[model samples]
Target chain A: MPGPDLLSSQGLRLDGRRPNELRRIRCKLGVFAQPDGSAYLEQGNTKVLAAVYGPHQASKSKSLQDGVVVNCQYSMATFSTGERKNHPRGDRKSQEMSMHLRQALTAAIKTELYPRSQIDIYVEVLQADGGAYCASVNAATLALIDAGIPLRAYACACSASMAWRNGQPEPLLDVGHVEEAAGGVVLTVASLPSTGSIGLIEMSHRLHMDYFDVVLSRAMQGCKDIEVILDRAVREHLAEGWTKQDVVVI
Target chain B: MFQVRKLANLTLFVTTTPTKRYNKINKSDCFENSILPVHFSVYFIFHRTKDYNSCKNMTRHVKIRLASERVNHSVSSNNELPRFYTPGEVITGMQDFMRGHGTYAEDDSLKASVAGVMQKVNKLICIRPLKSRYVGEIGDVVVGRVLEVQQRRWKVETNSRLDSVLQLSSVNLPGGELRRRSEEDELMMRKHLQEGDLISAEVQSVFSDGSLSLHTRSLKYGKLSQGILIKVFPSLIKRRKNHFHNLPCGISVIIGNNGYIWISPQEKSNLVEGDKDEIANVETQTVSRSERETMGRVKNCIAALVASKMMLDDTSIMFAYEESLKYEEVKDLLDTEAMLDVAFLTQHKINYVDED
Candidate 1:
């Protein structure tokens, strides 16, 4: 038996959505004023808050002649996850997250305009479910846009998983904590969903060589879906006129 | 008196719980968050961990300077306690503290990066969890106490800088007049709910100023009964929600990840039976029997350490909860497959009944 009752006989996943359905996405930009830019986003129970501190002076070590140094820090709240973490940041896991963040956001930000400058994009994950990294990248993108930092396009991220239930390979969308822990093949894609160009993609565990296309395609589809939602949020945030996220005077 | 100084990392006036309270830093300046409270005060600057360690290693002398008072010092504690530093003066005191007793080498940028904090005559001490968590955010579920009830709204002290308001309308008795009362419900005058009623509520909003407002809307989040409430450091409790499901009918345990937990009999169970420890080996204290019970394993070790007064923190909680989880009742509830699942021949239900 592959697995009991992950996809129902009706062909819906555990949370009763079709295999293609992503989690509910609700986002708001300008959630806070104390930062140059800020945004809060909720994807299912996963909540992420992002604050952009500067396009201020570049530190001596970080300055680049051709572009701005986009400094990104990703920190999950200690109580954000089911398991309690002793230290929230400055830890190895967070260091890895920080590095991943810098990688993803540096790609997204158009740094050439702000040459010899630094933009600090700090992402704080208040609550974490499964897709924290994807949520962080999405939230940080919104924060940078809210901060009025120029970007190539919305850098949206999403993850997909595949479980061969009932002898047929089924691609899962926006994999949640349960499926993630179930040791399925997870494919995470960070893409300029508008143009269908992937910036980053990671896979955990292995899948049948044949199932890679379906899984990667579903994850890219998730990225495109996320880009729509994020784009709408950016428009609504811009249409609302003055947002608090752009007003961090300090 | 120009109460010109706000106590930042550097400025504090530790008096002998002193009578001569002046904003002008004379000889009686105290260290910030006094390690010792009385007699002498020093204005030590806030140094980072490495910085403090380096300074502690150095025996170099630093000069102390006092600013000339714009107003002549008249900090008279009249018939009433003196209104020492005006708020503006306190802010100024904080600024002066930020400017650590002037030195050619002093760097304002270094200290300014650290938030300039100030406090009263007795350095207002703050328990900053360097890794401290933010207490509450909007829409978070929290369990708190009705510490000071005024009007219709009860001031609930959630895990935050200030207490939040839980209006009477948000809560219902077994049955109440209003199905759901409007905001018109008088906050200052409540129909029911006195001080000290332990209630469960949702954080409604966090004011820009960092105050909180909570609501007790759901049937599940309301008055607690039939059990005890334990308060620990809010940060100690994890702030994630999980259904402690399969809770025995007689017991309903509402644990706030914020370390405030409310336990009550589910209108079925009574607690009079008391927590009788079927603790094996209390009489004999042997290895074989003690190892059989998880509590026996830890109770012996921790009691030894505590008897020796070795301070315990995270490592201890892990060890303690690990052992505690092994109890048949707890293992049944927790089902920690990784740490637990050691077979005990005698089949029994899990202990430490956890209600999700």
Candidate 2:
């Protein structure tokens, strides 16, 4: 066991959040003027920007006939982490993140709507605070909404870690960088909360099978909470320019 | 000018809440008044929802809503602003309504697949987003830059989902309209329109893949020269019958439906018939200082209208132009405060004119 400081005697997490609490999520759609759809989402200390382009012609190599080709690229800024990384993308970690991002987003997008088309989603992490993947997924969801792409439901992702409190395994919601570096088992879940379907689940480090269900449910609950925030943001975006076309009632 | 003052009051009523943070007020009626203030919680919600003590700068993208003006000003309008729909929200439980773009039928109910306002045309319902890539329709005017020269076809980027195609057959040859497109014509394609050249064309057809086929068959619809191009959200541009207008202010504006606006000096006295050399030389002719100033003013005025989320038509733009005359300096309109002021005055003028 590490320092055991993840949860204090009062059951407060290291960041002063309650075990069941999540970080503050603030997001805005259509941040960039150039891309078809773009969004910036800040989850506590983690900041991510995502842009969606296309549902247009795909290059011959990447084209798909059965449904729209969903291409995703994940990259982090040079100053995003504490170390000042040498490369932004094409590395081993970013390539894996790119693949994982595509899997989660593809589950939400209605690909059949545009056969033989491709939607390119590019995510750039401006700040890294442990749950960067979760923030990136949330930001990409908002960007897809801004692009007017049809989706089954909002795909939300959240992270949880197993922490001991009062001799019981208490799963903390929205694990931050400090808690992650504390050598605890972190469970990340991306799902369509409305549909109760999991798109992707990733776990780093080992946890007993007896404590798995509680940790999973906590992360799932966090996903449900994130969906609500994203939904309200979308509605607010719609209301802002609801009258783009002057309805001609004949 | 008294009408202009009344117009200003109306706009002030609609848009005075941009700087008002949500923590200051908690009124329900304020939600319906405008869109951006409702976003006050977007910044305030973070502080209110969870208490995390860390220094971070929250940058809010300013959104100004002028749509409320149309709803509040029009008397015959019985429609409340269309109810917003988000992805997976059931549009109707009924199976009778046929789904259109931005929507789909799921589990025996009509559900919205996009985040936007729902538009119903009889039995077919579609969701039109506030902003998206340009969806080209036939007979629509567009300004696009050439992306690639591929054989007889020139791929043009029209701010659409895909690059639109401009075929050799669709354009009028320099010498004559009836001339056949020979091997030589294909070779000279880049000479006529190289990579990065801007042109104004009309949407001739929409392919099955959603790409548009553009044509420059008319003399007025060809290579654009010596003008400033301003791009806004395509939805800001109102679809009008005549997008090309030679404003009384001595500048011409092309309000492309694709959100590309080109402003240039009005063609000097309309070139005489069959003078291809003179028409070509018009590109080389220097634009005078006064004409350049007028174009700059028009460009800024259009930017002001776009920033406010107001419709961009010739009349609205002209009204904005007249309102901007007080600033004297064309570059002053680029400032956020000055842009909002001009947009407010323009809205007031539009609402005033509508009342008459």
Candidate 3:
């Protein structure tokens, strides 16, 4: 359990963010010329670059008859953290992060449209602040959109922490590194806000049953807010990359 | 003349000193005036700092810019912009219209599945993405690299979602056009069109799974040798009746519908019927230095057009090639400002033709 230092006297988190304010997000799509689709996203201090290749023919071992295989790899840079790490990927944490990423991304991609194909998504974390998973999910969604892959809706992920203000439980939106290290219960939710569906929900540490509802709802709200930002970014990219063929048809 | 002298002095300073401190100062100075000449000197400085041993009279300049400094080369037309759509955005009620390519029907509403402008023909509504893998239609021309030589078919990568198939029977053998395929031909598959060889073919049929079957029955479509291939977004390739162009500037170009452009020197002699042995020696002939230079200029011109996301066709490419002659050196056109200038001039010529 964390002390009352989780929230200041004015009901702000340790990073001076209000209970419901998300961190600033800056994103760009199609950053790389080689990949089918690529995106770079920054959420507060966490920067993630995602590249998506294929919907092309899948290998024999991974081919599916009814739908496309979603392959996800999550790797962090050796110097991304406070201390220099030796292994960048293939450890226990990266494998689990890769699985979680596939789950959230697969739920949004329209797999049935591409039969016997595969989409490979590679996410490289340059800087890992708190909510790295959330930023990874958001960046992968943008990459999928850039690839022109069909999607049911935008898959957005956001993290929230439970803080107490004057003996009242307040759910903090968009947890930061300081709040995460302070040992508060963090709830991470990846959801399709437009479809009103939850792709994945993960909770770290323990939270009371009554507090779970508020924390989950706050994370869901943050996803909805992120969907708006992502939608705008996609529009801006479309405007810049559109050619004469797209406009002359109308 | 003044710019030439400035360029000469800059290169002299770079090649003579070749120190880290001088290189650092030279890089910033060249970046400020990033025209054609400065681009060459900057390339020289980069070569000196990285590979001191191999620093000969290298004149090639490769421009590297930060992501924040990237220039948006998209040319916005004066016409009214189309209404764009994003994924999951509702296009219309499903009651009156049928969903097409990039749209999906859900909950009595037609929503777009890709981000782009919407197109409607009668009651069908489709949203086309600005960029995607090539979707082959019947009779579409494509250039593909041979990936695998299967039993009687060769797997081709045509920038499509699935690998295209080129059956052994579809290709016209060097001996004759109407020869039947025998087991000998199956054994000689790798010798004819092995892995990593590029060929121009036409889409014969589309499979139910969306893969394309290509054919190289025509004499014009066959093995491409001694050429430069430039790939751009498939959407930028404007469909035309003739994808092959023998430009007046002594070169031939094959603009594959799959967005692969092959710029090669014009063939001196047309292949006569039943000239089987002559086909073997085509790859061995040496291309002249002048022809190679022209091909390089054409390739750089195509790159410039691709940078601006312009529609690629024979006319636009020829216009760009003509506009690029002012730069003198082929490498000069690689500079961003020079590229933009060529693209702008070509666009102006294209618009002029359209108005006339």
Candidates, DockQ: 0.01, 0.30, 0.56
TM-score per prediction, in order, is 0.41, 0.84, 0.90
TM per candidate, chain B: 0.39, 0.77, 0.83
Order by DockQ, highest first: 3, 2, 1
lDDT of 1 by residue, A126-191 (tens): 898888989999998887766655455678899998866667888889988777776676788888
What TM-score number comes out for model 2?
0.84
lDDT of 3 by residue, B98-160 (tens): 788898988999999888888888888988888888899999999999999998899999999
Q: Write the per-residue lDDT of candidate 3 for residues A1-250, one digit (tens) a residue.
A: 4755787897777777899999999999998888889999999999999999988988889889999999999999998889897889999999999999999999999899888889999999999999999999999999999988888889999999998888888899999888888888889999999988999999989889988999999999999999999999999998787767834343
Which is the better candidate, 1 or 3, if ranked by TM-score? 3
Judged by DockQ cut-offs, the docking class of candidate 2 is: acceptable
Kindly list the per-residue Cα lDDT of model 2 for residues A56-119, writing each as its tens digit. Answer: 7778788777789999999999999999999999999999999999999999998876776789
Decide which is better by DockQ, 1 or 2: 2
For candidate 1, chain B by itself scores a TM value of 0.39
Cα lDDT, model 1, residue A245: 14
Question: Residue-wise lDDT of candidate 2 within B133-157, one digit each (tens)?
Answer: 7899999999999989998999998
Task: Please give the fraction of native interface contacts (Cα pairs under 8 Å between A and B) kept by each candidate.
Answer: 0.00, 0.59, 0.67
Question: Whole-model lDDT for model 1 versus the true structure?
Answer: 0.56
How would you encode candidate 1's per-residue C-alpha lDDT over B156-185 as one tens digit per residue?
766443466776666664345366555545
